[model samples]
Target: MHHATPLINTIVGGLVLAFLLGILANRFRISPLVGYLVAGVLVGPHTPGFVADTSLAPELAELGVILLMFGVGLHFSLKDLMAVKSIAIPGAIAQIAVATLLGITFSTVMHWTLVNGLVFGLCLSTASTVVLLRALEERQLIDSRRGQIAIGWLIVEDLVMVLTLVLLPAYGKLLGGESETMRQVWLDLALTLGKVAAFITLMIVVGRRVVPWVLAKSASTGSRELFTLSVLAMALGIAFGAVELFGVSFALGAFFAGVVLNESELSHRAAHDTLPLRDAFAVLFFVSVGMLFDPLIVIHEPLAVLATLAIILVGKSAAAFALVKLFGHSRRTALTISVSLAQIGEFAFILAGLGISLGMLSPQGQNLVLAGAILSIMVNPLMFALLERYLARHDPGDEETTDRQPGEETQLPLEVCHHALLVGYGRVGSLIGARLAEAGMPMVVIENTRARVDMLRNQGINVVLGNAAKPEILSLARLDCARWLLLTIPNGFEAGEIVALAREKRPDLSIIVRAHYDDEVAYITERGATQVVMGEREIATSMIALLQLDAAKLPY
Candidate 1:
């Protein structure tokens, strides 16, 4: 007896397939998003397989968008958002106009009406917030200047999409020859803008107070379940309320909710608790997006599909690249911003659906949008990889461009032999450096952060300024003569790469690396680390040692 379980089936099928393909994708050095989308395509109605409920998937994906935005908000403060506004605001608007114009041109070539082309252009203009955030988080760049600018730019795009969603219906009335007055159109636009303003103002003024209070009260109960539930309730409830009463998008609503909650002392705990749910739902979001893609669109309208994808990939990226350059940013910053905005996601789907409902977009147009989204998203990670390689090849010395004096060589002094090479100078690295300094030990620090590198230089310490993963940076540390290679970076994979490089350069060099997990320990050790200090294991060992001590005199 088979029970009717569409929701359960959808969730399980999506997750299992996503997991399997995700592993395969990672194995091949591809982004797991490609696998998730592939899984969706397999289970999608367009394919000959067990089709999952498409309607439920998007709703589940919406939760992903909400939670992802919420998590971003947790880390992004009001100050950070305001800091990037000068570049993000005008750059985003200009990029959107350029992409939209490109879209309109494509539509005209296809003999589409002006309204249809407008809808199509709009769909192609906005980048998916979820994709951009995920990319930043993966690279650990979410807090970087480039990441902040990308995020702020995305926020502006979201606002524009929200306005478009609200006004599309009124536009529909006019398209349908309903004699809708220009006054009504203006009224609708004003109402949407006013509501959005009110929501933002309310969240900033009232929410900043009430949200933290609620979390504090929940935390005081000492019930972890209650606390987690309170977080979810606030995220979901505020999002729903924003939609129902405030006419705001769920992504924006949940973002403000997280922003207010960020003021709470337990915001870190909140983020930690919801991380599993956030990741799982984010996978579902990608899977759901995949399910919408009809592969036949590619077969039937190859040129049109290619044209749409070119708009998303090339046209949008070039426009963004030029805008960032116009703002006097570096080639690296411009490339990063451009690549980040080269894909459209949830908002595009929403706008495409609305367009179809309003008769402004045909099914073919919607299919084209879906195709563009899937292809662009799948290739986005690869684009980033290329950017990394390009940067590595051309700008291996990240700080050497303008900061370094002409004819300066990044070599250790002839007197500084048998010195320890520290790969990071963050919190852990700084503590180790202090101890080394006190002992009067000679050491060289390899750090990527400009400020930290500058501070180290001012302290009269030998430091290499660039990513240690670069062979030149490693060579600058005099790895051949270094007594020890200390890998203190939190990123285990990156640490492993540096370890391997150092080992290949100096087989007898003692390599000590810090790890947060057993797998990291194993990976780094396998790459020739002499010792892997597992933080949790060390803490446990210390705790056990304390337990063995005499209880009466140990503490009161």
Candidate 2:
């Protein structure tokens, strides 16, 4: 008997291989993304063994794209984009043009048609939102000025891609010798644009009111499961509705759904709740992209792959760097933005897929884009590391001298000293913070979540929006001057690192950490935590005290 169906085998195999390779990559201090893509290649049809269900992967990948775009929409900020418009808009446009031209040149050299070249160029123009965000967040730069500009630039790229996705089918028809006449082509274009406009208008006007109302009602029910289900329903429902009614893509619909829901007070909760599912599906998406990449391309078309890499890593970076510098930013800022944008990921896959579907891009073109994406992602972290080392060696005070621009609030006061430093602002951390605030103690919080950072600031607390594990972020929290360091985040291994770093930085600081298990207590304590607080022990002690008090009151 067959032990597993295609769907089951694909998911289990894809996830299992991705997990193993992803761990291996992380162990080697490489991005898990490289491992995920490589996992796809290993299980791909082009591979020798354990080929996954080819038909099932793309369907799963579509869900990933929808959720990923929805997440983008949930976090999209019009105000933030407006703030960086001066540089982000022009820089992104110019950079896209430069990259597209380079891609066209490569396509021409490969003997592809102008239309194919155009589609390939367009695919190369956009950067991967997933990879870019992860890179920025890992380094604790998402709230920094450079991060803002990079994010804003990505938003513009996304908007352009959305438009391209909408118009591409019609444009492809026009170019594919399918349109009856130029008039018909223009008419088709008008209809597509009209439908997109109507969808956006309805979403902004109706969805803005209805989505929030629905979410508020779901919240009022006080059922976490119901709220989560409601958020998913909205995302999927809107996306389905858009395709059914407006001829918009699932990604575009999901993006608009997220943008509309982003206006709700519950947006952060929506994002938090959907994150796990989003990440899982996103992994599948990357794996699917990998499955499409034939490794033979590297051997069969080495120069094509080389040209693609040159365009992605060199040409694109150069364009972004020049544009940012031209916009009057510092060299450091230019480098930061350039390095951040030096890779492509999800959008490239989506655009390449669309181009293939339209019969404009050959399978070879898609493979080249995939190959380029993998190489660029692998090199991105190194690029950032090099930039950091360069800055440290040549301009030791560059990061310190870069002042916070207007509307940026992650900056901590240089004078803050002898205060308690709290990492994370989740449930346990919030309780501890409230107590500290009520006791009139000075405290600083280091959090990576933007929403939580806003909440903390609104309560008149000083906060740094970044991961505490990074030395730069730790520096921003004034760890050297901190009297106490509290680890309220639940991850034991991560807490150990933070404790070890804190102890190394300031040996006199009193460090308190919370853990869930016995081994975690030992692990954290050994790593220099002055006190390791265990939940089970604390609960047991409290219960024992209550029982004893009751017995004494009963005159036993």
Candidate 3:
């Protein structure tokens, strides 16, 4: 319990440092994490400036990691976890085991003690979920099978990371203390695991019951900040409690707490609230990591760094590819997933700190490892990007995203091509869908509704369930190639924004905007919109057309 001044200093410093470095990193096309590391090194005791309390940084970093994992769990619903589990679990396990083995081999070759080698291996086995998820999003692969498999693989890595955090320390202690009995070590390890299990059970049973009620009661305050604070308290409190009382790793507790909240209505909201802080704190975690890098190691021990990088990438990726394929997948899918996940993560940051505290490895060795971690963090995204391009070009699993409508899109006024574009798939969207199916033009409907996604999918149509306003949805529809964009939502404000956003991306897109008011018709027309339909005008236009057809039937 220090005063407010230090707390403010720590937060303000971390945030300012993060923002500036992040911008710089962005400008350079480098991982902002590297910037965070650089920022930490500058502020660390090794430098002359306002040195932060050494422990303060990691403590704050723990907050970031916990929130990040919590956010991951919150968004990674039970459905998603189960959906991807088939590949993620197995892929993750094989990757970790292989990477760890490789790390151990390298350390052993370097004449490290057996314990040090194993610890080194464990650290190398994890991947930064944050970096990978962002990369997946950027590459727009989140909806693909490879993305699903990659996610599942990461879950396995996370589980292994937790186990290593808890079990490795005991192993290290028993190995180091010649007098410590094997029986004693086993007892401690078992107790630790039991406590971890019980902690998980308690969080699931008790927390599931309590958190929703808390969120429900608190949400009416209509204060986003309060909601954010509540989420933070729950995450940090459980994480800290596990460490203080049950002797479980904070990472495990944080993850379990996130799992408990997976069932809550506020899961996504909770995730949104925690992300900014997670990002800032996560940056510190990376930055603190950078401070540990001794420039001398790279200069004098070049082989060590090169060897570590090789073992992490080539050895781990190969292991992952083989294990995943053996488990059940095409070689292409397995290779793509494994290759993408071949790097280290923030968990290793915690592990490195633990290793230093336990004196298991020399500071120099730890520095080299931290340097490697930063380099990996920086490189992981680029590697994933390269792998994505390679998979797209070569793998069947790398199919380009397309919006398959449940049925055809029918409209009063429209353009037609090899495909029909359904802008909104609500009740109106669905009705148009049925008509289009009858006509048999390849129909492509883009919708924002989640419930109808599977419903449409069940009907053998390519249903893109996302914001139609986004250029990605437009590109998915192949707007330049597709002849029409059927806009169903008649809200003028949303329509304008969507139109603007679309035009910004694709200037020649032909959209038939659905309008409710006469003023909006003028507004839409003035903007050079292709067409606008008023609800009243739709009935009138059909009535006149029907009359004309009736007159023609009279043989006039």
Q: Which rank order by lDDT, best down to worst?
A: 1, 2, 3
Tens digits of lDDT, candidate 3, 142-212: 54556666766776676566666776677776767667677877776677668777876787678878876
TM-score of 1: 0.78
Error of 2 at 324 (Å): 1.7
Best by lDDT: 1
lDDT of 3 at 208: 78
Model 2's TM-score against the true structure:
0.82
Please give the RMSD to the true structure for each candidate, in Å: 6.2, 4.2, 10.2
Query: 313 in model 2: Cα distance from truth in Å?
Result: 1.5
User: What stretches of model 1 exceed 4 Å from their correct place?
Assistant: 397-556
Question: lDDT of model 1 at residue 250?
Answer: 96
Ordering by TM-score: 2, 1, 3
Models 1 onward score TM values of 0.78, 0.82, 0.70
Against the reference, the lDDT scores of all candidates come to 0.87, 0.82, 0.68
